[model samples]
Target: MVFMNYSTSTWILILGPLAVFLVITVWVIELLAKAPPWYPAIPIVIGFAVVFLALGVLIRAKLGKIVF
Candidate 1:
């Protein structure tokens, strides 16, 4: 078995972008509910989530080494 070591800040760096993505997704849902748009929101949101998740992973991999 293998275990990963993580500190508070390290976890934050890894999850921050994902957290932001979740919050923004909620806001987008509200906006969509208030006024539906012609373009499909699903693809856009999916892409946004991908970007955020990638960024979080990148930050964790890079900054995690430097900071912690």
Candidate 2:
């Protein structure tokens, strides 16, 4: 298959964001499904936190600054 011809780094580049997106989508959906009506800000705040955390990770990864 054409996909099989990609290099290892190419595979990681393709799969990393995809995996992050899938996980975040599932997490948000599950939170909304079970969250109470009075707790709407909980998801928004947590979503922002997750977004910042992901952005930090993306920045570090882009800079090749991973410590571990």
Candidate 3:
């Protein structure tokens, strides 16, 4: 019998929901500080997310295939 050091299932279930909740909470707090008509804050949030995600993908792709 062997024991695993870490459980990927725990992270897949727990951390996934936790990460979503944290992002939503931060976005709501930011939007509340901005003003009324919550619509505007949405675009800003989405745009920032998209740009960051794209940058991450680009960086990962470059790193995955490197020749020196």
Candidate 4:
């Protein structure tokens, strides 16, 4: 049986989510500060959310399984 590294797994999860959250928050804030209520930034926000989610999935996959 292979022993997994819990510390590495934790860091991977934390860093990926943190980075994605920060980026999305910044983007939305910027758009809101500039665009009007009827602007098209809504779709762009959705697209970014999807991309960030996919990135999280990829990060988890790369981290593999953690047994501890």
Number of the top-ranking candidate, with lDDT as the measure: 1
The lDDT-based order of candidates, best leading, equals 1, 4, 2, 3
- Summarize candidate 1's per-residue lDDT along 1-67 as a digit string, tens digits: 1116776776676677678878887777667666656236766776877787788778667766676
**lDDT per residue as tens, model 2, 17-47:** 7578667766776777686773566666568
User: In terms of TM-score, which candidate is strongest?
Assistant: 1
Residue 37 lDDT in model 1? 69
The candidate, 1 or 3, that scores higher on lDDT is 1
CA-lDDT, candidates in order = 0.70, 0.65, 0.57, 0.66
> Between candidates 1 and 4, which one is better according to TM-score?
1
Q: TM-scores across all candidates?
A: 0.58, 0.48, 0.40, 0.42
**Superposed Cα deviation of residue 67, candidate 4 (Å):** 12
Winner on TM-score (3 vs 4): 4
What overall lDDT, based on C-alpha atoms, would model 4 receive against the true structure? Answer: 0.66
> What tens digits encode model 4's per-residue C-alpha lDDT throughout 1-68?
23353577666665677677868767776777586873667667767777877786676656645422
Model 1 stretches astray by more than 4 angstroms: 1-3
> What is candidate 3's CA lDDT for residue 31?
70
Clash pairs, model 1 backbone = none
Summing lDDT over every window of 10 consecutive residues in candidate 4, give the lowest-scoring window. Answer: 59-68
